[model samples]
Target: MGILDGMTPKKLIIWILLAIGIGIVLFILMLYLTLKTKTTSLERITPYKESLKRELVTLRPVHIFELMEPTKSNYTYAMSDTNQYYFQVLESETGADIPLTKLKDSIPAGATIYFEKAVNYTNGVSGSSTPRFFGTISYKEKKYPIEFVWGRYTYKSHPENLRPGFTMDLAPWNNRVDTTIYYLPRGSF
Candidate 1:
């Protein structure tokens, strides 16, 4: 009664309403100004884009005769598991033999490779006849397991069973067929 003695209830309510409206307006203006001054870049907006980009294309463990993308097959790379940077997935092939000389320096550090193949070897005692491949890839803490099968006993071979066998074309440079396809590991393993 002391402060409102001269003011009617209706007038006091009106003043309160006016103050709230002004506060709202001020808040909106401040927010707009702050937003306008801030710079939002693509990278800044999507910081997770780089790390999760590779996970978007999940390399399934099981597939049915899937062909590697032509463009990607040449470059052969995969995105990082937790970073924006990209890493190369080197494609090393063997002609029933060991693959191209692996260049440790060529591959980026912190990168890992899992490679396996099964060839229908000439015979178990001899070598691979028809190759089937199986592999598991691990990036950071994640793993990608894939299996490629040719026939029976095409992909799975005991780790202790060291019989290196493979069949591959050396890019098939000419029209004439090249017979340097089969690969047999050296030494009596």
Candidate 2:
């Protein structure tokens, strides 16, 4: 009581206002730091999220060629007669027929062919229909099934030549004139 009696009312009011002002400033600074931390954390996670989205949307072509138990040496001679091998190209999603004449010379034996056309995918949607090759390779009066599917990963071996937006040809020929295209089957990552 004795100390309060000496202090003026105006001085007490000023002291109270100054204390409130300091408290307000500290509160605002704390809020700003919290927001900045949250923003930094959001920025850090954005790239990883985008990468995951790309991986989900990106499609890898499926190219599988299984050489039979008894691999035929003279595959070209065996398939000399066009009638021996039945080739049908179909659209994967629609099952529509693609003309065989268009793909005839393009898929030569032992050639790693790349399609001029690029497959476009937008937001996980594929721009072009996948091409499915269904055919039988007959040798010694025995028909062996040879199916080449190009679109999306389904097998363990992912060829380096194959990419998300390109169609790749993996034809293993015994009598290939081109020495550069011949490669032993080693699984790709």
Candidate 2 per-residue C-alpha lDDT over 1-189 given as tens digits, one digit per residue, 9 for 90 to 100: 686787889998998999999999999987655443110111122211222211111122222233222112222111111211112222121232632222222122332222112111222122222322333443233343333332332223455655333223322321222112211111111
Q: How accurate is candidate 1 locally (lDDT)?
A: 0.32
Q: In candidate 1, what are the lDDT values of residues 1-189, reduced to their tens digit?
A: 498889988999999999999999999987665444221112211211222213222222211112233112322322222111111222222121653322221212333334332222233243333332334444466454432222222122446755533323211111232333223322111
Clashes of each: 18, 0
The lDDT of each candidate is 0.32, 0.30
Q: Who wins the TM-score comparison?
A: 2
Off by over 4 Å in 1: 38-189
Q: Candidate 2's C-alpha lDDT?
A: 0.30
| Model 1 clashes, total count | 18
